[model samples]
Target: MLLFDLDNTLFPFRQYWEEANRTTFTSSPLTNGLSYDAFLPLLKMFDEELWPLHVKEAITLNELRVERFIRTMHALGRSVNKEQSQHYFEAFMENLLSSITMDEELRDFLDKLQQSYTLAILTNGKEKEQWRKIIQLNLTSVIPFEHIFISEDIGYDKPDPRAFQHVLKTLNVEARSATYIGDSWTHDIQGSIGVGMNAIWITPRQASSINENLHLSRTIYDIEPCLFHLNRTTTIT
Candidate 1:
């Protein structure tokens, strides 16, 4: 069985997110009349400022999503109430959900992989939202929904060994027998390696995630090379 991350690894999430944000902010009444070109830079700036705070655990995830918009509005000289901000965020989610599109090449690779392996998605996110991606990307057609693991549903997030353990036990596979692939240095690579699973680190920059000289980390620039590597070595079931 193969374990995979959904966002950024399987698809380019930033592209989908940008498209959704443009549509949502343009259509929302709360924004008063800001065009996407004008609004996006502010949103990006706010998002960049909020992320470090989020990583530090200074605010909850809900606050991370809602407060950024509120702060952006305040920065623009428009004050927004929390409820209105939440409504705006929800609308953004709807737009994001609608914009989910699978990468054609990755989809084709997964289609071939499933013929000889049990493919499963092990990712972190809200259950409902993750399901929306699975449905939108047609992931469930290739890998059953039951095999999908979402942190919100499992009550454990990645980098936490418990999350990886749950997926291993559920899939009835040993840590050594399974393989994990994702974009994160901590959550995906370290977490899977801690549990003895082989991990493929996908990064756009292709820099060393752990050390300047990683002894055994399998780093790939994109999923294509990872697919090519896997195809050569895939153990037929």
Candidate 2:
């Protein structure tokens, strides 16, 4: 069995993100002529900074959505009311959802993998948002609907052992028999490892000193060799 992460794993997430931001920023007068290049990092910074609080339940989803925009605008020396922030959020989401599309390369890859493996997606995100993304990408045609697992639906997020365990139990897949593939090191790599499942890390970043020993694939398509080794190792053990 092969399990995968959603964002940045099945698709080129950063590229889509930039496209979404560019569309939204250019269409909005609220941005006050701010360039997408400048707006992207400021908004991304807050999203990353506040995401932990949302995951820990320190803040509600609505609060996280609104606050990120408020902080981004504030950083640019602009005062934004809650209503204005919500407007930005809604517009950005609309643009994002509309801009999301799967390329032929990823589609063909998943199609071929589906022929040989029982594929599943275990991802961390709001249920509605994640499902919309999957649908937008037309994943249902390739991956079974029941195989998609969302953190919100499972009542736990990635990096939580319960989340991984829940999926394994639901699918009746033993830890050793399943291999997880994802981009996040902490959430996908460590989480799967904690459950005794094999994992392939998808990262384009150069290996750092702290992670010199682990093999990393620059793209999801680069995992064929790793998968071969893992399957062989699993069979041997």
Candidate 3:
């Protein structure tokens, strides 16, 4: 079994999310030509106030983005009427969809991996946003649509064993037979390893430090090179 993480693993999350947020904020009438630096104070105020509500709901990144904007406007002493907030949220999401770009060589790597392993997506996020990213990135064409799993759909998020168990049960594979690839050490690596699944840390940004307990099978700076190595190793063995 081959499982993938959706956000920063298959697609670059930081670049896409930042660009999408900037576009959404600048395009909105709420900003009113305010510089991002000037507007940031309000955004921070909103985050401080609204983040607790999000944590209660397990706070998917997409939802947090919208909430941040909504609360920011409110913090600036501007009334974000329900209708306006809804409009901004929708527009923000649309911009996010437009910003998605798959990592280079990801499609070809998935194509090859799919032939030898049952491939699936294991992601933690709001169902709609995660699915939107999947579709926008054109991942549905590479991996089977039925194999995708979202935290919102399952009522549990990564770093939770139930999430991994859901995929294991769906694929009818033992934990030992499966391998998970992701960028997050806590969410993807530790989460999968906790459930006895092999975990590979895809550390493209060098953001995380290696943990001894996670038992990571490998680390790769990029997916294409890793896939090529895997193919060659499989052929040699």
For this target, which candidate reaches the highest TM-score against the unseen true structure? 2
Query: The CA-based lDDT of model 2 is what?
Result: 0.83
TM-score of each: 0.82, 0.90, 0.77
lDDT of each: 0.77, 0.83, 0.72
The ten-residue window of minimal lDDT in model 2 covers: 206-215
Per-residue lDDT tens digits of candidate 1, residues 1-237?
678888877777778898888888778888767666767788788889998787677987788888888888887878998899999999999998987776566677788878867788899988899888888787877888789999999988898999999998988888766778787989998998899776677765643334211212333234444444544554312
In model 3, the worst 10-residue window by lDDT is 212-221
Q: Best candidate per lDDT, number?
A: 2
Residue by residue across 136-197, what tens digits does model 3's lDDT show?
Answer: 77788878888999998998888899999999998788886677788788889888889977
Residues 1-237 of candidate 2: C-alpha lDDT, one tens digit per residue: 888999999887778777777877788888867666777789889999998998789998889989998999888888989999899888878888888876678878989988878889999988998899999888888889988999989998899999999988988898888888899989999998899888888987753222222346788888877776666667311
Of candidates 2 and 1, the better by lDDT? 2
Reference-based lDDT, residue 78, model 2:
83
Q: Give the Å error, residue 100, model 2.
A: 1.7
Which pairs clash in model 1?
none
Candidate 2's displacement at residue 189, Å, is 0.7
Per-candidate alpha-carbon RMSD to the true structure = 3.9, 2.9, 4.4
> Best to worst by TM-score, what's the order?
2, 1, 3
